[model samples]
Target: MAEILLPLLVLCPLAASLLVFLSAGRMGARAIGTVACAGVGISAVASIILSVMLLSGPVAGGLQVTLWPWMRVAGLSADIAFTLDRISMVMVLVVTIVGLLIHVYAAGYMRDDPGIARFFGCMTLFVAAMLVLVLASDLLCLFIGWEGVGLCSYLLIGFWYDDPANTAAARKAFYMTRMGDVALLCGLLLLACATGSLRIGTVLASVADGRLPASGVNVAAAFILVGALAKSAQIPFQAWLPDAMAGPTPTSALIHAATMVAAGVYLIARVHDLFAMAAPVMALTAVLGALTLLMGACTALVQSDLKRILAWSTISQLGYMFLVLGCGVWQAALFHLMTHAFFKALLFLTAGAVIMRAGHEQDIFRLGGLRRAMPGLTAAFVAGASALAGLPLVTAGFYSKEMILSGVWHVHFGLAREWTLSGHPLWGIALLGAFLTALYIFRCVFIVFCGKAGTRAAGRTSRLMGIPLVCLSVLSLFGGVIEMPDTLPSLHLFSALLNPGTPLSHADEPVWLVLAGALAPLAGLGVAWVLWGRPSPVMREIPGQAGVIRPARTGRGMDVLYDRVFVQPFRLLAWLTRLDIPGHAITGTGRLTRAANAGILGARAGLLEMLAIRATGTARWAGHLPGLFQNGRVRWYAAWIAGGLCAGLAMAVLS
Candidate 1:
């Protein structure tokens, strides 16, 4: 049953995407949505059944389904396979279930749009690809799905092709993520070279048994870490996500909350065994995650656009997941991933409805007193905000966050005596991020929903939209009860479910840490109420000091840095190519070739003349060989590839 269901999970959506493309606008929006929803519904059901079966069996049980032999090359045996263990089980549930809800919400959100068919096609394809990412047992096979989602995201982000900015944003996202993808492919090759296979289990086992040397482990881990960093939008790679909001709101929700950004954390958690052995890489991850957390939280505090606020918040929350994963508490990372999915989805969807009702206006300052115009949306927004803020006892975010905070408190990382890091400072950074998370998110909520009707609004959310909000709201508030701390019931159900035999024990939490973690959110709420809950003018001060808001809003100039370092040089090379200099050089070579042939034919005096003509012809022919590969239009693309190869070689030589 599990075997049949496992393959069916990916096939269902794949078939539906094909149907959507085949239908080709002949079917109405209703029919297209029905097809997409039904496909996702089947997948969600399959996920439930497969999860039940995995849990019901022995402690180490999982379902590994192999479809066929993918390849056999130079001692490598790779298969197209899927694995449903506890970690992937959690990922499968989130991608399928939350994805299904988002699809349903999108059906209503996009009903009036003319490109509904194309939208559903790319969206369903996105879900299918994400499922492939989480479930694959082979690392190389997972890259297929990894690139698959990148393609779908590009298509969906530019779904409204009429807008030039939308297409540019799509291109920007594609180019930035491609950098990480290249590094990831390199890491995969490194592992394959070390272990002679790309199977996840084989790689982990080999690395654990010391089959790979220590330096090999460190290099592989560093490469994979860079990949995850760009994908998850941490620190240096955080610029693209805010611009990614050029897509539709539902697209924003799906990508930010349930799927693409979460892929990085899932990949890290999936291969945590490798990270545990590389202490320096782990410390680097922790430091970067903490930096990104503070950066994202601070940026969100100053944004006026509602969607951009959520966008920055996603960056911050993912930082927490990265933080916990770096600290060797991947289960806690995943727990927050789940809870973050629920609340983040809820918040994005509700914000979409709010924007729709307020005449497509997204600025929270321009939208006020929605508490009167749309009461239900106000309540839903509050529910999501409470969870995002991690307000005590009832909200799921608090428990998951506390789980992470606890893990951070106990973690220690260092490679040698000269380079050591305690969890205390990073934990402090995380707690500060937590406080800013509460302050910024609730600031949006209060300004948008608490004031008197400042902007006109009409047309409440439809039943289709409301249903997902209601379901997610409940999940956002109650999901963390399944995993409690030592002071509580000591419920290790979440951890226990992941690794059946090793339930974590945590009875000795420090008083100050526990007390501070619980209070940070509440204190932030109090500050927000003092600042935003009343009729006060908007403040421009960033966290810790007075600073320029524009820089924070633009991800603290990371974009400018990248543009200077990466984009400008490439643009210069492109402009030089578009000038057609290569084409002219090729034409000159053709002229030289013809002249040399003429000289050769004309040479008939003696052996000396013949030898000179032959020598000249050989030189001309060799020069002409260079022109054979010049395509004339934009050699920039070819140059990029050649440059990449050169860089790779340089790196090899340097190493």
Candidate 2:
């Protein structure tokens, strides 16, 4: 029964997307919403049932179901397979249950949209793709889902195509992610070449057996890290996410919560075995994670836009996941991933509701004193904000974050005889991030919800919108009790469920470490209270704050840097490539013409002119061939890829 149902986890929503897309204008908004919700809702329910089944069965090894044979050639074979292990179980539950809630909310949020059906279709498709990405046992097969989510992101982010900003954001995300995806593909190919199989277990076995050289392991792991970093929107790749806010709020929520941005962390966690052998790469990952964690927290602090703030917050939280991952605590990385999903989703949805009521106002400063106008929303927002700040003892984020902090403190990476990657330094970065996380989130809360009502909010919260917020809020508040540090009762339910026999808390962990982790958020809350709790105009207009917000909001000019450094240069190269051949041919013709006029070919000048014209025309026709890949049409590019794949396969079979 479990085998029969596993594929449906991805298929349900995929089918819904297809059905809704095919029906198109034939279906009304309500019908479309029903279809979308039913697809994800069924998957969510099945995920719970499967979780029950998994709890009773072998969790470490998991149950596998092969849906179909994908390919076989060149000493390699792949299958369209799914695995329902503890890690995947967590991911499935988060993707489906949280996805279902987001879909339901979106149905209400986008009820009046002319493109509601299209929106739901793309969203359902995205859920299906995310499910595939998590469940696949083969790395090559996983790429299908990986690319699936990227394409869906491009579609959903640009769903409101009339808005130039929205389309640009979508393109930016697509191009930036592709940069990482290319590296990811290279890594997968390297693995396949070395191990003769792309199965997750097989590749790991190859690494353990020393079939793959140390250098190969390091290079492959580095490529995978690049991909994950870009996908999760870490420092260098972090700018795309804030701009991603041009999409609708539900899109933002889904992407931030689980479907898209978190994909990178999940991938790294999945391939931890291989990463473990690449110690230098692992240290690099940890260092990068710390840098990203600090950068995201600082950038998020100065953002005025409501959704952008959350976007940057997502980047920062994901940084913690990577930090633990780099520190070789993949389980802890995943633990935080689950809790972060609950509260972050809660926050995004609550922000959506507030934005809708406030006449689409998104600037936190503009939305003054909303706490009085919409107390329910204010309460919901506060719950999420508290979780975001990881308020000690009460919030799910606190436990998950505590697990992460403890993990960071316990990391034992030795860089050299006298030097090592100490947990204390990274721990310090994470603790500082904690402080900023609380301060910034609470700052938004106190500013937007506490001050006198300046923005006149309209309409009431629909049941659809209110329900997800309420459910997620409850989870955000009480979800942490399942896991606690030694200083507390030492609940280990979450750790046990994730990996049985794994200790809930580190043995003999210093007491002050946990105390410091607890105090950081409290200190942040205190600072936020001192700054914005009283709701004075003077407090709102803090001197020298603009200087910080300006650079931070612009991602410290990373966007401009990208435009100047990468984008402009790429555009120039593509432009040159497109004309390089024909331009040279024409220039040669001009040179010849001048020479002919100089009497070198005076008697045959007419024939020379004819020859020059013919040459120019022929060169123009030939020039486009060199630049076909440079043209920005996706369909044409895909066709090129298809043709290349066919040729490669033919050569392989023939050889």
Candidate 3:
């Protein structure tokens, strides 16, 4: 059963999606949704059992799960396989479980939507694609899953196709990430060409065994990082994510946090051996990660839309994941990946609850004191936000983030023999990013739960919604225990789960470094409270100073800078291609061809007349053709030619 169960996870949801499409009009939409959700639920359960079975045994045994041969062409062969080791198992479990919950929540959140059946179909297909992504053993198979998820995201984000803005946002997200995917495709080809194998485990093992060239790894790694950066929404590629809020909340949670966006981090972790060999690429990845964190944090400070803030924060948190990867802490990145999934998914769901109550109003300013009206929802939100802010001792986010920062700091502090600190720029960036994370998170919390409630009372939420929120909140609070040590002096429990066989060494750290890491978030929280907890009369009196306003208060202005920088130039180039170069060349070549082909009858007539005159018995006259061909011959010459023609005709007739 277990052997066949792996393949079922990928096929069942897909078949269900087809069934959903067929049943769309004939059956009740709710009934169709229930069936779709059940399929994902079953797959989720199978995924969990598989994860447990794998982790409980030897790591080698854990990595063995080949469903079948996927493709074979020439020298490159890829198998449709599933590797159930600790990392892949963890990701697979998170994707399926969180995906199923979001599916359930979508049942309520999108009940009134007319495209309910279509929505479920897309969601089911997305889960299926993500399952293949985590389970696949080779790059070719992984890419199929990768592009499949991207397609599903495009479809779901623009689910409300009637809205042009939503459609445009969806297009923007797809195209931008596609640019990165191209680079990644190149990287994969480079790897296959150099190593002669597309199997991830094989490549990693070869690299680790020193059987591969560092130069090959370096170039391939660089290409992979490009894909990772674009997919993860790191820095320059991040603007699309905030704009992605045009999607429904459940779609937002499922795609952004639980599945689609996290593929980048999972990519790097899956290829840790390659990255370890490519030091230059790793360093660049780290730098880009730091930038993503800062950009997301800074942008989130002024966001008013609840989902947008979370979106930016998601990007920022992804940055931390990449930063840890650069520090050679693959396990830490994977841990953060798990914890971030729980908390971020929770935050998005709770935000949906509030927004749902407010009649779909997303501006934080319009929403306040939700805690007073929706106590359970408030507690859930706080728990999730606490984890996001990495608050002390209450959530998994703390342990994971702390571990990452510790790794970053260690690398920045000249711990690595080949690397030296030239003032530790990455460490400083990490601290600033942490402070901003806390500030914006508290701002989000305080704005929504601390002041005055919005127009609608919080009692409007359904039990289905509230129950999921509560479940996520409990997970957010206690999920860390699975990763925490029983005693402080004992080894950190996550160390074993994250790095199964790695050696651990204890070291004394500088007090100031420790203080900076500890106090940064506290300071951010304090700042948020002072500014937003209780607005002062004097502060309110200051006109035109709306720095305290939530980010979306600016509306489309949120993406205006992006349009000016990226979109406008892109549009201009497109216009130039259409109207300037290719357009002109096409027009010009068309005009020339038309001229050469035109007046064919007139040209043929002139040629025939010339031939007739030349063929006549007038070789001597033909020598004087210039005069004969002229229209205005003299009257005497015309009479002489007429008489000569008559004589010749009479002679031929007599003969």
Candidate 4:
């Protein structure tokens, strides 16, 4: 049963889904919902216990449970095993905890929906798949979980399949992520072929001992990066996430908070040893991460749709996590993942609560003064927003953000220099990204929660949905205390959990360096206040005039220009499929069989051409008739048959 617990951690949700599916279209949906949620909750609690037990002891005794040999062939072996280590334990806890909250929230959020059982079933399946992904001990197992989560994402995104937009968004997400999945799969295959092992620990050991070739390492790293960028929605592959907001808000929260997007960070962190071995790969990771961070923050600054803005923000924050990992701050990256799941989940659930109250309206421009109307939700939003802005103290975001900045700072200096090219100047770019993060977060907060209410908020209101908001608000504030690192002194509980590969080179940081890190968030908040503190003519002036739309049409927006430059050419090639074929060409394929009809002049001429070819061939080589089927009307058909008969007669006579 102890070994069974690990498998049960994943199977519970899957079994629950079967029960849910069978119970659909009946009052049994309620019971199914309760069982599914309870099953997941129980798994989450068990996983936490496993994590705590592992963390309290040595690596050998930590949560490593193997059931049976999953495969054995060609000197390769993969076990159907689950390992509960420090990193994955953290991830599963977040996935299950946040997943449960969303489920409860959905109980009220989707109460009136016609497809309640279906939705709950998908949710359970998603949780099960995600648990397997985090728990898998090998790359092949991880990928099964990987693709499983992606499949669930497509289903959830288009849960309302009646809407063309939802279906389109779902397709976009699936296709875009599949591009990454291909790369990831190729990389994993390369790793297996090179080392003859797909186990995580074995791969890390080989990489660290310099047993693998650098070229193979680079190829694998690059392939993995392609998948990470695609899955995490980094630049060039990021457009799908914003469009993905067409799904229910819970789907948005799940994707952004725990499962789909987080998989990229998980992959990188899980395989940090391989990344460290390939110096060029590490540099590429840093550059890509920094670029995605800036791009996402800049886009978030200008977005008006609340969900779309949050969508971009998720990409930006994930970029930050990637940046931390890229700089070789493994613990800091994981810590940020922890805090991010809490606050981002809180923000999204709060957003869901607001949308529920407002009859599905999600435009920030149409929302204001919610602080007075829905105090619980407003407070939760503020708490999450403040954490996002990296405000000091009383927030999990505070600890995580500080640790990430500290990691960046360590990279900029000479500390934590395990990987080559250690002293790159990308840390400055990362700091600028931090500033942008605070600015855009507050920009959304000020616009949606602080001002006067708009038409959308007039009648939409509810009290039952407020509970998750309050619960997540508390988590968002204090969750940082759970995993505090030693480098940051504010909250220091779990500092040892995140040990930098090396210590801080200097015992003390300069006053200005510390001040700059502290001040980045404040500066961002100020910039947000200046832009969105009060609505000005800039908001009202552009829509009616051709001033803005003309440039957008002319491709002034950098993103649009980038799409045209890099992606549109392929789109143009695909556009050829849309050409209007004549109905005759499309529908008259069978008419070709009637070409030898006797009524047509064009068909009759074809018999002479066939006879000439047969005569020419006979003169050369005893009469061969290769073109006997090129018949014209009935005359052509008769000539074709006569030519074949004459050729046969001549051949027989010659013989």
Candidate 5:
């Protein structure tokens, strides 16, 4: 049953994509929408059933289904196989369930667009690729899905290819992720070379049993980490995501919340053993993740565009997941990944509803008093924002975030010592990120929904859009109950279900960490209310002043620095290649070749003319000598013959 269902989860979306694509010209929008929704709908149902079977049945060692031999070479082989385990089950559920909701929302969101069928086809294909990625049994198989999602993202992001900016954003995403894909490929090769196989199980077993060397593991882990960072949009690679808002709102929700960006975190979680072996790389990951969290949180604080704000928040949240993975808390990172999927998708969809109603104006400063115009959307927004802000006691984000912070605190403090509030630098960074997350999210919420009505009037949201929002809103609010902290023991169902062998333990956690986590969101909310809840002169003056808002909006000069360092240099190289190298050097080669050819031709012609002139001169000289000799004097002939004989005798004597 598991084997059949596992393949069906991936194949359903592929079949739907093919159907929509083949029938695109003939099918009406209704039929296209029905096919698209049904495709993902069936996949989601299959994922649910698969999850239930994995949970209830004996799957201590994950269930693997091999479809065929995908590829083989000397000393290398990878199968077209799927693995159904705890981690993959979690990822599949999030992708299918959240992806289905986004698809449903997109049907309403893109209904009027002429390219609805194309959009659904790409969306379903993206879902299929992600399913393959999560369930893949080997690096080779995973890479196929990895590149598949990258291609799908490019297609979907540039879905409206009429706009130059949209095409540019899509290209940017494709190129950037490709850079990481190269590194990921290198990592895969290193693993295959070292472990003699690309299978996930084989590599993990090699690492576990000390068959592979530590140095090889470190190098491979480092390379794979770069790929993860780039795919996840951390620090240097993060500039593409905020600009990725050029896509449709549903595209934003899908990429940011559930699919492409999440791939990075999933990759790290999947390869946890390699990272654990390379402690130095894990430490580096921790530092980078901490820095990225701060970077994204600060940037989100000043963003004016609603979608861009969510985009930055996605980067920041992903940073938190990386930080946890760095801390050797794979379970916690995945926990946040799951809960973050719920709230983040809810947030983006809610933002989509607002964008639809407000005449497509995304500037939060321009939006106001939407609390009354659309109550359902407003409620959904609050739920998602609360979860994102990590509000205490109720929101899902809090539990996941709390677990991460606690993990960080525990790791930073020695195992011999109890958890302490003091001397832990990472704790401060994580808390600061949480504080900014709460402040920025609520600031946008208040400014957009709590102020006076602006120019755009609120329009009615469709039932399709409202349904996903309500469902995700519920999940955002109550999803945390599954993985409640050990501080509250009764709601530990998530830990039990996902990781029954390792229960949530509170013995090492101090009371202060939980207290600090609970207070951070409140403090942030207080600051936001004071600044933006009322029409303060400072808030009014802040938006208009470039000096105040530029740093945060520009991602604190990270973009500027990257442009100067990477973008400018690359652009110059491209310009040189296009104009200088080809235009000057290559074109100059043609001129040089022509000049050499003409010079050789002229030299050859001159030499032949000179020889001809010499030949004519010799012939004329011979003719004159013959005329002289033919003077017809017997005496002269005799003298000449005697002189010739004498000269010949003298020459022979001398010789």
Candidate 6:
């Protein structure tokens, strides 16, 4: 039953996408939206059922259902299999539930667009691909889904093909992720070569049992880490994600925030043993995550665009997840992944409503005083923003983020025997990141929702858009209750369901760390209040100075550096290949061919004229000989006739 049902989770959306695509020209927007929503909704239901069953049943090794024999070679074999474990169950639920909600929201969001059917089609396919990726039992199968998501992202990101900027953004995202995909593929190949199989379970088991060497695991893990970093939009590869905001807002919600950006974290968590085997790589992951967290937080602080602000926030949040994973807390990282998905999706969806209400204006400075007109949206935005800001005890982000910080604190202090006052450097950096997260998110909220109404009139939101916001807003606020820290005895539902054996108790946590965690967001909120919450002359004038905000707006010169170093050089090479090399070769070949043809034609004409002249000369000479033979007309004729007759007779006698 699980076997048949699990594949349906992947197949339903795929079939819906196909149906939508095939009937695109024939169907209206309403019909297309129905098909897309129904498909994802059904998958969400199935995911719920699977989650229930897996939770009730024995889920250690998981319930593996082999659909077919995918491949077979000398010492290698793989199957199109699905694994329903605790981790996968959480991922699938988040994907399908949030995916279905976004699809519903998009139905209203994109109703007026002519290309709504195409948008829904690509969106549905994207969900299916992610489902396939999460449920896949083998590395090869996962890679197929991996590339599938990449393809779908490109299609959806550039759905408005008329816009060159959107297309460019899509291409940038595709190429950047492809670089990581290549690394992932290399890692997969290395794992296959080392273990003689591409089955993820087999590889993990081998690594756990010490069947594979540490060196090989380290190399493979390093390659996979690069791939994960690129996919997750961490650090250098992160420039594409902010630009990806060129896509529709719903796209920003579903792919960029909720599912796709988190795939790298999922991949790392999924193959954690490989990382654990390589101590150096694990440490590097921690450092990278810490660096990205600070970078994202700092950049997000000064962004005026609402979506770009959230985009940078996502990068920063993902860094926290990676930081936890690197610190050897996979479950904590996943917990953060779940909570972040709920709130971030809510945030983006609400931003979409805000943008629509503002007549498609995305600049936070321009969007002001909508709290009264659209109370529901304003409340929803506050909920998401509060969660994002990690406001005290009420929001989901606070709990999840605290867990990661706790984990980091433990790893840092637990390792050293000395009870020094100096905490881990990452802990301090992470604390600062938390402060910035609170400050930036609230800064946008206060600027956009709290101030005087700007020029744009507030547009009405449809129930389709309003309902998802309401639902997600509720989740964002109360979702933290599920994974309450061990200090609280009543609620450990998420921890128990996800990690039954290992209880994360806070009693042993350092008191100073807890104090910092509790105070960081408050401090940030206080700072933001002073900066944006209260009307100030400085706030008004700061927007005009390009020098003051340009660095943060441009991702602190990372984009400039990338364009100068990577994009420009690549463009030059591409120009040479596309135009210079081919153009010159074609022109040179045409010139040489024309010159040779001209010489050949000239030679032929000269030779023909010379032959004609020679023929005329021979004719003239023959005529002169006949004249010489006949001095007088009669005498010449008689001599020629006699000579001809004598020659004929002599020839006949000789014969």
Q: 615, model 2: CA deviation in Å?
A: 46
TM of each candidate vs. truth: 0.87, 0.88, 0.84, 0.81, 0.86, 0.85
Candidate 2 RMSD to the correct structure: 21.0
Instruction: List the pairs of residues colliding in candidate 3.
Output: 302-551, 303-550, 303-551, 304-550, 304-551, 304-552, 368-452
Model 1 C-alpha lDDT per residue in residues 458-569, reported as the tens digit of each score: 8878999999999999999998898888876678899888877786657788667767888999999988888878776355334443457777765547878898998899
Per-residue lDDT tens digits of candidate 5, residues 191-215?
A: 9988889999899989989987878
| Selected candidate, larger TM-score, 2 vs 6 | 2
List the candidate 4 regions with Cα displacement exceeding 4 Å.
412-425, 456-464, 482-495, 498-506, 534-655
Instruction: Decide which is better by TM-score, 2 or 3.
Output: 2
Residue 20 of model 2 has an lDDT of 95
lDDT of each: 0.89, 0.89, 0.80, 0.76, 0.86, 0.87
Ten contiguous residues with the weakest lDDT in model 6: 413-422
Best by TM-score: 2
Please give the lDDT score at residue 361 for candidate 2: 93
Off by over 4 Å in 6: 59-61, 412-423, 541-549, 571-655
Candidate 4, residues 75-126, lDDT tens digits: the string is 6888877887767777888888888777777777777788888888888998
RMSD of 5: 6.4
For candidate 6, report its TM-score. Answer: 0.85
In candidate 3, what are the lDDT values of residues 39-117, reduced to their tens digit? 8988988887777776677755664567678767777777877766767778888888888888888888887888888
Task: List the candidates ranked by TM-score, beginning with the highest.
Answer: 2, 1, 5, 6, 3, 4
**What is the model-wide C-alpha lDDT for candidate 5?**
0.86
Number of backbone-clashing residue pairs for each candidate, in the order shown: 1, 0, 7, 6, 1, 0
